[model samples]
Target: MATATTHGARDHARAQEGNRADAMPVVPASAWPDPPCAAGHLVWAETVAGGGSTHRVLARGTELRLTDLTGDACAHLLLFAADRPWERLNTADTVKVQWNAYLGEHRLLLSGQGRVLASVTADTSGRHDALCGTSTLVRNSRRYGDGSPQSGSPAGRELFKLAAAKNGLSARDLPPSLSFFQGVTVREDGTLEFTGSVGPGGSVTLRAEQDVTVLLANVPHPLDPRTAYVSGPLEVLAWRAAPTAPGDPLWEATPEGRRAFLNTAGFLASRGIA
Candidate 1:
């Protein structure tokens, strides 16, 4: 038989224990380190504004990190082999090879020829969109009633087209892109829904497996249902990384990863890059 006073004390003690447990330090998923390059030596860095785009050529063994400076940022990215421009990233192959519909960390960006183009080495925003493509000028104009680059509301396709022209590529060369920091969910009826999951300071690091030309558009996803067209800026950082070792995590992520890496390695070796 316990008294009311004893019962109250026990309840208080349990509450305190729960409070202490809640106070324990918990690390966020996005608390990843910067690229493994020299602390002060950055190859390139820039802040891409919403509805804007940028492109750059990255050498093999180099890593590029994209940080969401503001929450709700989306970066649509396309990768092409620098040497062989025809060999570009294939989103279908990338997802099919890994047997995963969702892209995340440790996934290799596979080229059209089943070769590794780049690898997602580190990712703070785990949910990236592979199915929903970028928004287009016509689509945006129809949706928002204003999709002019001059009006400062260019669509993702418009930005991608401009970026492609800078690299001497044409609209026909533009393929499907991966939308980083944007998440999509599939309903029971096979309908896709856009979901925001990234926060400020969340970042994703991609390690190039070959000399790759990257085209990125900081724009709202096509399925983004925000009425006001809220797209945030993205911080880009590029740094040189060490050569991939035999025990690299990307290579060991899956059987498909190993195969794609070997294909890429063989291609490079044939080109006298051994």
Candidate 2:
């Protein structure tokens, strides 16, 4: 395999051809912070589709930002009471309270019982999909009758089972989810349709209404082939406090990654998800 030096040499050669004035500085991997300390709180993680997945949080009052990182990424976001994991995010109530079909600056996340989760304080490239549901083997099987191991993991189904056992809730008690950074188009019938995302590198930031445990995960879609994944590694990052004013750190992590950990923690917390 070509070492970082080899890649650097190739980049230098390209820069020389472009001219010194046109060349851009290349930040080495070593120079960049190797992820952040905020990741320590992560309790659960899994390899997902797409490449370069990671997650992290900021300190109290510190702003945590989530970027799609790549274009066309659909992220499922959930939040639970930090003190009680059972009290999960309620997107339905959020939509009702905001009186909007889509989530954005106008909407705030609500818990299953109709409590505020977080407000959508910022949305870059305002194209997020609300109807696109969370990924699961149940949905996958309906899409593809039967396929190879590449067709989403049957193991992924364990998420629900685990949730049921941990929270003491039946499968029926799971909360509905919201998909972020997706495209929702109103059709001629005035119905919302799930299209592609707005574009790559879009993001959103939320200010917690209460102490909340956010959950995010990146698993292969039931329809995608596992062999095609470039880097299916799972990354989980957490922050003890909110981020500083300058902005949050850049992470290869997807919004889904954060939600996964949040879900587990919240479900187990005092709220009692079951």
User: Tens digit of lDDT per residue, candidate 2, span 96-138?
Assistant: 5455667775355667655455656568857665554455655
* TM-score of decoy 1: 0.84
RMSD of 2: 12.2
TM per candidate comes to 0.84, 0.55
Backbone clashes, each candidate: 0, 36
Per-residue CA lDDT of candidate 1, range 1-274, in tens? 3336988879776766524221121122122245346665467666777777888899998888988877867999999998688999999999898998788788888899999888888898886899988988898898888776655667887888888888989999989999998889888999998788567878999988898999998888888778877888788888777546568776777788888888888888999985
Among the numbered candidates, top lDDT falls to 1
lDDT agreement with native, every candidate: 0.81, 0.47
In model 1, which runs have C-alpha deviations exceeding 4 angstroms?
1-36
